[model samples]
Target: MSPRPPRRLPLGTATSIGAAVLAFTAITVAGLGSFGAFSGLTSARLAMLAAPEAVEVEATLARVGITAETLAAAGCSSGDATNVGADALAHLDTTNWNALVSADGDVRDAQAEVDRLGKLVRAGQADQEDLTAYATAKSTLATETSTRDGLLDALYDAAVADLTSGETTLLETMHGNSDRPVPLQYTVSDRTDAQWTSLRNALANIKTSGMCGEDPDTACTTLVTNCNAETEVATAASNLDSNLAGVTSALHTALGQE
Candidate 1:
């Protein structure tokens, strides 16, 4: 069997900084929680196909649950005050279990959303690269048309000026032609260009919004999971591995791997 062309990977989401201007903005990225916006013939199959992403989401959700528990226990009360300073420790309690639930819901929803997006991709609804290319092509076409038109208009004006001039140069005879080339032989269809740009831009916007299907959910969950696991495992194993030497040292070291 011949080798097939390597498939292109999905474009990852851009990191949107929560800046002064975009503080209230919700920045979602495709592959958020990595569930990949569930869409396909079978939800199970879609999930299976995207299992890597799902595992990622699962790990994240579990971690988020842990963090919520941690914060709640640590007594970080929540409110607008969390935005304050050293005193913000009180806000830790503010994160409701519902917040964790909501995060879970987002992670779960990503599977469905990504599947939907995938189906759309298959059906040719909104392709990111296609939209990008379309926009580029439209821009190029517009610029080229304008430049070509300008050149042609200059050609026209120059042709007229040269032909009408008193200079004895019969430029037409040099090319062995009887008449001059037609100047201003160009076309500019505003409707066509506008339509193309509008379509491309619409697709670009769709592509941009759909980009963050489950990535955020996945990221939050993963951070919680890994950090919590690290904390717990370290706390537990450290007690077990006390004063390692010859025979026990290797076993203790292997336990550290866990």
Candidate 2:
């Protein structure tokens, strides 16, 4: 005779069977005389499972603010871009850069809430409400991170533009010359000779280093140093002109030609 087909339990019957198994487990624990120990072990196991996730979440939240701050600092320091010139500085909005400060504070608060919820979960005292709150805080942190990243992108672009314009202006001033003829008698003094040499050396260094070409931030710094050198060159040139004019005037006065 063929065996009768095996019967499948109905939903209600299945639920009863599950309950019986749980009850048997409880009975076995009670017989062991250490049910409390078993419960503690189960809670500890749950906490161990949840701890790593909580730590990872906290680390992610921390990075959101740190990355924003680092980008903002890089943008602001790109080359004294704010003070170089009105047209150049106008390209950037320095005020909005402070947004990271508030965003970081909000992220820290969210992370603290997550930690509290994580503790409750570890202790086996958390309800659905605690988990739900943790999820909400995570969502808030994500939003803050997105906002911060967007602001940083805009600020970085503006800073680069400002630095580029400033670099162009510095280069023009260094290379361009006056069209008027200078007197042959207006020779440079020993001090002027040294100043001219220094300026030439500064320009040479800038050319070899490729200032404002490859890395704008580094180029901006080189430009500042060169600007000071250029000033010295201008002063020396002006002194030579003045000395020449004095000599011409003295010759004309002696000849009674004036």
Candidate 3:
């Protein structure tokens, strides 16, 4: 038979594990056990942590896409998606990322509009001959991005969904556990991998969908934009060298990141 599942806390609920840590420390000093205050921690906690990071990933992804879009929207032909990478520097999960989770709806909406317009211009959806079709594509693209951005704003904090979003249990008994701190570097690396996979997919789609404007079709060239993005985020993560390097030797280099 399959093993019974685990339980988790809820969003807007009182988990304050930080507070629980202090309580747990006091309890331990008083000869109490380790499981009292810091209760119910499981492998699932990593998912809770990654959600916020994933949200950052989404933002960074959006910004990069937006920069390319902005350039496309302006009808300029250059791969200087640098502005997009620069924009993401403000909110990488490398530092305190929870702050970014509270972005307003308007900001997301504007970014979304930019994404839509960029896709159209890059895909050559707008032809100079058919002013009507070009105009329609531009307008529709703008609206698409706006709605996309608005959608993300609502689900921004949904990271905590892992807190219990997939689990339910009235009673939780510690079966087997580890006191090990979730290797943050490892988590960041995993997020980097996830981001890379996403980039690869986008790179492929941009070409197949003809969304990247005119270019010599090559796999490496297609991902050139995302390669830089991976490097930027990796550099940000590498900023905390000591925190991650000691965790794993793999952290020393940014491989498979592009």
Candidate 4:
């Protein structure tokens, strides 16, 4: 007998098998397309994420260069005396001697006594000894006033000298830092900026006699602000290599290939 013709699959079974195969093929193709599309979208997102950071990095680098150049142009040298007069004025010691009291009341009382004695002398209501005593007291008061003023002046001068030296030191350090490698420049900038901030705080906190006002010298303030700005730039510039590397890594991961 002829080999029973190969038993045919049931019609329903054959149709079901064919439908499953076609569905699997379509799913595979669609999956591949979806993967490609997802990759492109991820790449675009990574680019978007990196763009702002890239711009910030470039701007910071440029700022670092400009700040270094500015520091160089600032004539940074030790022993700079640019603000001597202003500093001296700022540090003036305006001690009120009249408010001070010894065993004999305040200086104002002493002055008042002198004035009273003089009035008595002028009115002839005082004798020769009283007149002599009044003149001596007046002379002594004048001498003490002169001495107090001299001491205050000396103190003011010393304070101003200290300020000048401090400023000079900062300038010299800034100059040295300016010519360093970019990263080291950032490091030094951070340090010096801190120092500048300390100095500014000290100066700003100074309780002056209000003769020159309570504000710090403009030059010192400007230096501090500029230094701080440079430090900000350095904060960005110093991280540039790492930032770019991170961006690259993120992009690689997004693309599903390194």
Question: Pick by lDDT: which candidate is best?
Answer: 4
Which residue segments of model 4 deviate by more than 4 Å? 1-106, 162-258
Question: lDDT scores for all predictions?
Answer: 0.29, 0.39, 0.34, 0.39
After superposition, candidate 2 runs with Cα above 4 Å error: 1-95, 162-258
Residue 242 of model 1: what lDDT?
A: 34
**Best candidate per TM-score, number?**
2
Residue 220, candidate 4: how far off, in angstroms? 37
Query: What is the lDDT, from 0 to 100, of the residue 229 in candidate 2?
Result: 55
Model 3: per-residue Cα lDDT over 113-225, one tens digit each: 55666666678784664455556655665665455444333232232122231111100111111111221111222234455465556556556657546653566454545
Q: What ranking of all candidate models by TM-score puts the best one first?
A: 2, 4, 3, 1
Give stretches of model 3 more than 4 Å off.
1-39, 42-45, 48-67, 75-79, 94-96, 101-257
Cand. 4 Cα-lDDT: 0.39
Per-residue C-alpha lDDT of model 2 across residues 92-165, encoded as one tens digit per residue: 22334234334434656776877888888889898998888878877876776566555544433433344444
Worst 10 residues of 3 by lDDT: 169-178
Worst 10 residues of 4 by lDDT: 95-104
In Å, residue 257's CA in model 2 sits off its true spot by 55
Q: Which stretches of candidate 1 lie over 4 Å from their true place?
A: 1-95, 123-238, 242-258
Cα lDDT of model 1 by residue, 14-119, tens digit = 0111121122211222233355453323322222221122122222212212111222222222321121111212221223222322332343454455555556
Instruction: List the candidates' TM-scores in order.
Output: 0.18, 0.29, 0.21, 0.24
